[model samples]
Target: MSRALFRSSLPELGSFSAARLRPTAAVLPFSWTTTTTRSFNSTAPIVEPVSSNNAPNPTASQVRPLALKKSHPAAPPSPIADSVKNLLPFLAAQPGHYITVHIHGFPYLVQEGDQIRLPFRMPGVLPGDVLRLNRASVIGSRDYTMKGSPHIDERVFECRATVLGVESEPLRIKIKKKRRQRRKRQAKSKHRYTILRVSELNIKNLEEAAAE
Candidate 1:
């Protein structure tokens, strides 16, 4: 049927679009209530992982190669000089010998029964502990002298020292102040030294050295 005939059949549907359906911009009569909640203090509890030396590799392509350690090559041994071999026996027979013994790269000319004060304190050593000095640059007597370019063979001469009590210097205090200020800064320092006495020094004979 036509639209006019259908509208006349029902009077209740007359002018429904103009009365029931409101316009888009028009305000509603009853209150359409709606409850909405918002949260502002919420946070994600998941933590991001940090990269470090102990972290595991994710794939074979990401794996790093192991580092190789570098090592020093060994130096060849040097032969003993001809002059030292011939004169060692003559020097051993002489009496009253003195040797320049080296300890920690510092040389000290000491003989048997000579007391020496080391410039610094030697750690882990107590009184009466014996120390065998192996490095030397010179060994001599009244007339003859034997000198090594850097260090002599340890078998040529034996030198020993005994540790004595430590020696401490007197306490020293220095006061520093400004030209016009009463405030002063005091600097204090105290140093300790190790005392050692050469106990034995012997020049080995050719026969005795050969047997060893």
Candidate 2:
């Protein structure tokens, strides 16, 4: 009876060994386990997919910096040189040129056969007397510029106009009468202006002016 009891107990100990000795598969730290009382927690934080330096990509709702346009500054004006003014007499002697001529500080850009109405009546000149205009500031080319002497030589350019005589405008007569006053005075005034038709605009060569 003792030998039979030992044999049964030995079989039960072998069965317990068979059930406890089976190996369990290794579980990764990140893997979830349903049997855990709280879900399996990760010791390491979850890493998201990144673009460049491990920084997470922003969403479409994020604001982006705007590209700015660069503006160009304006160019400065050209300065006039003193050397250009010294060469003007030779330049004026050339044939058929345009000149910016000034008369008594008032500037006029004139060529031949231009008509000018003087602002006020010019005194001491008759129909055929010639007038020489000299003051000029600039003599220009399409690209090059030749400035004149601070004041042009009075004898340099001849701007002769045929004085077409004085012209009178329509008479302006204003009658003065008060609301209660019976006496009325008539004020009459008339203005006459000189008209000049430019007959010849000549920039004579020194040789030509010398011969005359």
Report the number of the highest-TM-score candidate.
1
Q: Return the top candidate by lDDT.
A: 1
Which regions of candidate 1 deviate over 4 angstroms?
Answer: 1-81, 178-182
lDDT of 2 by residue, 123-155 (tens): 888876666655677554344344555755545
Q: List the residue pairs that clash in candidate 1.
A: none
lDDT of every model, 2 decimals: 0.80, 0.63
lDDT of each residue in 131-184, candidate 1, tens digit only? 999999999988778898888878778899999889999999999899988899
Candidate 1 TM-score, true structure as reference: 0.58
